[model samples]
Target chain A: MSNKLLLMGDEAIAQGAIDGGLSGIYAYPGTPSTEIMEYVQNTKQTAELNIHRKWSANEKTAMEAALGMSYAGKRAMVCFKHVGLNVAADAFINASITGVNGGLIVVSADDPSMHSSQNEQDSRFYAKFAMVPILEPSNQQEAYDMAYFGFELSERLNVPVLLRITTRMAHSRAGVQRREGKPQNSLRLPSDPRQFVLLPSIARKNYRKLLMGQAAMEIESEKSSFNELISGNNKSLGIITTGIAYNYLVENYPDQKSPYPVLKICQYPIPRKQVEELYNSCNKVLVLEEGYPIVEEQLKGYLNTGKPVHGRLDGTVPRDGELNPNIVAKVLGMDVAEGQPIPDVVKNRPPSLCQGCGHRDVYEDLNEAMKVYGTGRVFSDIGCYTLGALPPFNAINSCVDMGASITMAKGAADAGLVPAVAVIGDSTFTHSGMTGLLDAINENSPITVIISDNSTTGMTGGQQSSATGKIVDICRGIGVDPNHIRVVTPLKKNHEENVRILKEELAYQGVSVIIPQRECIQTFARRKKSEKKESND
Target chain B: MKNDIILAGVGGQGILSIAAAIGLAAVNSNLYIKQSEVHGMSQRGGDVQSHLRISDKPIASDLIPEGKADMIISVEPMEGLRYLPFLSNSGWLVTNITPYMNIPDYPDINEILAKVKSLKHHIAIDADSIAKEAGSSRASNIVMLGAASLFLDIPFERIEEGIRQLFGKKGDEVVQMNLKALRLGREFSEKNR
Candidate 1:
């Protein structure tokens, strides 16, 4: 445990949580965030410490379950991607007002460059919106230290602390020193039971308390060693850096000395004292932050006394996508003398459906059936099958959120767009699509819900899907006609039959569910490999 | 003293296996290693590259700055070229002469090999055939690591030990197969380079 383990930022956070008295860590698998939970699940510590490490149906469930553990006075952590934060925002925002009985840290791994996400939304804004303190680590060691210290801050403030990280920080590996492990909290309920029950009367007072607590939170940020303004003799330009952006800035100066006075803000509620000193000491201020220019805008809005503040907003840095050291160098007026141009032979390689994938056959049939119905009528949800929206299939019209396909198709059907189709994967269906399907049944909308049952969450590395064996029953239970529910194995031989079935379903006057049942090819391969090993044994 | 390598391949082709082997060896040698990788949707048969930086001194950035990479070890031929921009002008390019034909517009296999052979600092090996000869088709990644090891500063014995440590859990036979694969690659590099 004392050894310096080379760990990804996500892995560091997981270890930090273990060392910080974590009783449970709940999450759904997601890009950039999946490794955090996977590390804990694979670790021997989960069993030794008796911590709860289980996948939830969705991010909201994970958030609420973590809050439930906090309500029992046990430190709990929840990790998810930035988009997953949107899914869990309801519970996340409400948890702030209710506050925590035990330490709780919500780790939202943001994809600033939209590397694997639909958008590049920052989670620090969520922290600000929820009126909670945020810890943004600039390196793997600090990522561990922040997780361990974040729990104490969460407990002391009686609120959930937000641990925000971006893709580079989440995926990049570096050596991290370990901290001493702590014991899990003994189960103890909140002193005031109604503190969580947000009845308007109680909620109003709690809301006021949260508002009145901002000053104290700001004072904590002011006193925090994590928020520091380092001294420099050259005061021509002041640099403000936060999160992984600090690494990019520091990387420009290999000697680790930026002649400019710098304020490195890792723990935030916007340390006004550091900002004041930085602004006063330098001629101009340059802000470096990943994602949206929230910090830059905040400084300009609240503290700007006519001194020029330059960042993403004013074009000091690119407005969109993640920040890199090269861009950082360019902004700092440092020369980047290296790097050759990519040759033309190296063509773009966009992600495609794997060969022999079940979704491939399904999309083929769906595209054939929909060709008669025409394009722009199919609404798909997020998953591997969202790849159908690409290439020769070009099968789906929209893929906005987890379950938006069914609901969006339903709305379109209601608008008299007959034969509207919704294609959603099994895991995504269970995540948020089931409720939309039920609503479609209630209205008897003329929409065909094609639930591609892959028997696992294929997109996020084949986790056990919530809808493994229950898709048909769930549809029937949702009040869809049992006769209209059809299940088919997605294979090339079944293409003609599957297309016929899809055509019939699209022609249906009421709610219909077409269940294309097949195990994901990747999962099948893994199972076959393991079974081969087992048989050899 | 240092090795800045870009491990390139299509997702699901197991470039990470090579990274894992090299990482284990680097750690065993007490060298600082920082590796940055691609995850998520790209795993659905897309182009992927991992930046692996190992040095005797402390490492700073996770990414290998362009034109600073000491070597390019690719499991796919075109994937090796895909990272050409990152490779230093004099860096070694060790690539498998196999084509992962997920894309319809994939350049001709011969064309890829021709370009690779055209380079003064290139070692082209049919790792798949070499791995199969070594007794396991999946050992191609190990063969890649073997080919790459010729350019690395770390000891070959440590990498062989790394293979044992990494694949020993799978079974002794599998570990032995990979060790054989690794040796085949080193022998190939010695003959060809």
Candidate 2:
């Protein structure tokens, strides 16, 4: 069992967290980051240890819960995708002021190429803004090793550690070696009384302490094993790689040797001294990073020393999209082999809502009902229902961030767009939509909010939704008129009746909610399959 | 002792099982392997591709560069053609002839098959029928994998063992069905070539 195991970077991080004495893990399901929690949940060790592995309602709640576990003197890890970090930014930014008694690791899986994400926002900026130590692994082994030692680093520095990974690192599978396990920490309060309290007098003092602690954090980064300086034979061009970009750089070199002085900066605060070494040793500098040119931008400071700094900011590298070995080779001025282009016979195959999905039925019925009102009035949240923006359905208008549907619809309704509809998933409703629903109800906004209840988080592979079987109670609790809150089964046979219900909700002057409740088709099939297998056994 | 493979197919087409089988065999042979997969939104019936690399030497990038793939192995016909840009000039294109028409604008099956046949090194297999003969239509992905196995440098018996190890949890009957499916697919490819 101690031998090398084939694991995805996310799985490796989960194993490392478990082996490194994790007492709790919290996360809201999002792509690239979802597998980290799913792996921990599926593992036998976490279950045996009775570790807290339940999904949180949203990323902010997840972040706070993890901080709470850390407050009780136990190692905790909070994971989410790049956008989820935006949701958790409030707690994440303040955690640095109120240092921790136990280790805390915040894992942010970024999507640089907009792969399964709306925007290519970098999570490193969030870490930097919070003034926390960052760990960006270059490979699967480092991903595991960082998680293994990251807790100690966090505890030693008395601050939360940020483990930032991109989509490639999160989803790629490689062999990872295991490390010796550490025992879980016992529950104990922080030695400093009033540390968690953020009163202005104490908060001002804590903020100063955090500012003073930056030097120590940078020193730890300077000495981190993940940060290495490799001296090369040539000095014409010095290359700096952060995270998985290091792999793409070394991939062009089969001998695993680059001609220029290379500073592999996985641990951050830029590891100032090593960067200075590389900057001084070579004539020109090239910074390769997966997402934004964070390091590159820093190197080319306000008053440049006139040393050439080439990266995404300049035309040296493509400003957008993810980096690949071919891109690296091209930038290195190497001849890359051009393959045959795909024939015209192959067409675009964008992701679509699965056939027989409840979202599809909801979209069909809603589209039919919206024919009179016309399109561009249905505001949708993030989920499978977002695909309704595509052809065949052409139902929804906007697919902004989660919970934006109801709030945006309310705003639009406030702007004289009457009966603006909001299409949201059940899981999303609990995540952040409930509060918006409350706002709409209090204002009596004339918006038809469609809570397309799928009973599970369908987009990120059917995680247990926080709002399963509770939509009706939630709506009632939000003060929506019970009569205006209607439930309809979204099926082809019930399409006519479902359309009628939607139309009625749309016509209402006050706030109205339509719940199209059905289990996800994929999850339903899986449940039926397992049930059949059980009966057979 | 290196093979760069691109596994392409529509989501829910079971290409991951094909990847699992190949990955197990590669790991069993003590080779270094890296597989990059598409997850989340792409799994709900979208075009998905996995870049799989196995080598005697340590692999660096999880992704394979364009025009360097040793083979384009697909469980669906058009899916195979979609990755032709990644396939090497001498590389083989092994694909199932069956069409997965989930999209509304899917091209004609005959034209897709004709394009596949135009390639110098290709194996267009009726793996659906072959899998049906082997006792389960669900094993079509395995059949496609079996056809692609001929060009793979790994030993054939190791692939059989891989299927056993991968599906061992499902019971012996399922494994046996897949083994038969693999064999039928291999025999068809051998005769056709």
Candidate 3:
């Protein structure tokens, strides 16, 4: 029987990891990458195989935990969005140096055009900086195949492999044929006693080993089936495509035949031999990459290669955003008829907090309270509450990275922006706000911190939050006065009371945390539905 | 045969269910399918769309090229117009007449309807009423899918089986309600078109 299933690219990666004998999959929820872990968590195969699937507090914790699993001689995979890589950079770079006893694949889903992200930073640069092999899947099938291939490559080279994907590659669905399941590796420790230790003397040896492995990694990229040079008769213009960009190129050529010789590179390390061959044969080259112009920039260094290489830098492609078949068709000089301009009658509909959302109530109360304190004092973190910066409320002043709310508020307070406030979600607070809270307590930084406790992550589809029932204890543990750490239910009826509590906290000279405790409306609705089903039964 | 469709709706409107039924049907027919979905922040209440492509040959891009979509099946009238740029000149616009008025500045219902009605090829149905008539208003997405199934290259029976397979875990009652919703929608389209 054919074991074919229709799966999203994220689900394909999860199923691939399972079939590839994954012992554990660790992640902190973020878009385009969240579904990978969610799929693993919900799948029957993982439960039957006893695979460890749990949400980590943050990307750094997830990366370190996956590294630790690899240290135990069991295959582990860590998944996160592109920006999450910034949080895990320290551990990620060092992991390459420490290498691995078991296979480790770090899946970083990049969001081009800022789809669900604050920025459009490509993850391939990080892999290049760490000098590890990178697997960029061009489609759903490749996304699945890469997991199995990445694990083997990771084990073969004794290094962690980076599997990079963009939003389209992660969220798109296609049919994927499954491979036979492999048995999980039994629990065992690394053979080298001092391998994971980063003592300076050992570090030098590890760094040298990583630096030396670049050649072998390059060799692997050259021979990888994922990266290939398709022959074409026309040699006037060659093309180099990475990741899903290759799909756009093929999409323009429906016959699956481009007139120009194309170097389809889904593996990193440049695969210099194939690239050089293509570059040498064609009179000019066009580089197509999804996110950044890493390949284009590399191919055209400070001293330009005489052959006119064109890409983002040269304006052959629009400098930013994702590539679609229309863009490729236009670039290839093919006529494209984009149907019609949307009539002006269509109004823009931005995402807003749900009507009954606790975050909406909190923002309403916060906006009302902030009227007395004046505006431009609220620093918010990444979450659904970040939506407070928009629309009817327009409450928050800044929406930076996760956990930046508290620290930025403290810094602003230090700069004499007195009565500065930080509003963060419960999940984000536990993710990184706890440390900033500790800092505020140590010096008594006069910043009012509002931990909008929704009891679930609320953003990225309500994953289990580590701070679900422990926010009060955590605040008390962090040395904030019990009296100052007030809690309130964010509801319409309690609006005045919540505002009074907020005013008290803002008046305090020391650190104060006001947690508005309410269940997320979406999750609450889901619970009600399930509960009603149970009652009906 | 190849068919590229754009499923459009407001988030939380159950458009993914519509995409799931069609995807399942395409898979059952042994057609190559690729569907690109929107997730994360915009899913709160913003406009959400899915690019669904099915072909006898292997599909390449997850997104349909501009002006290449064979049909746009939207659960909301205004949401359908949002993807007009992706529709081919001859593409069909199958949308529900329901106005998901989450936004403050939603256009007049008649204005949106006039725009939809002005299209060369379009099917605007009161899927909510049809679904309710079929025993469940929650199956409006399935109704929208069925209204669109007329233009889809796949067989009608395949789509019925697809809905059955999709709602099977929810029990036979739910499946039967959705199947009834599907038939009512197809009936409405057959009468009107």
In model 2, pairs of residues that clash are none
Descending-DockQ candidate ranking:
3, 2, 1
lDDT by residue (B20-40, candidate 1, tens digit) is 888888888888888989998
Better of 2 and 3 by DockQ: 3
Error of 1 at A220 (Å): 2.3
Tell me the tens digit of each residue's lDDT in model 2 across A168-264: 9999999999999999999999998799999999989998988999999889889988999999989999999999888888888867788878999
Against the native chain B, each candidate's TM-score is 0.98, 0.98, 0.98
Candidate 3, chain B, TM-score (2 decimals):
0.98
Q: On a 0 to 1 DockQ scale, where is model 2?
A: 0.71
TM-score of 3: 0.99
Fnat (0 to 1) per candidate: 0.58, 0.79, 0.83
Error of 1 at A211 (Å): 1.8
Clashing pairs in 1: none
Candidate 2: list runs displaced more than 4 Å: none
TM-score for predicted model 1 compared with the true structure: 0.97
lDDT of 1 by residue, A1-537 (tens): 215898999999999999989999999988899999889999996898889998999999999999999999999999999999999999999999999998999999999878788999999999999999999988899999999888889988888999999998899888899988988889999999898999999989999989998888899999998888888889999999998777777766756667889899998899988899899999999999988999999989875667999999989899999887778889988777564566567778899998889999999998888887677999998999999988978888898999999999999999999989899999999999989988898889999999999898888798888888998888889899998999998999999999999899888899999999988889999999999989999
DockQ, structure candidate 3: 0.77
Model 1: CAPRI class: medium
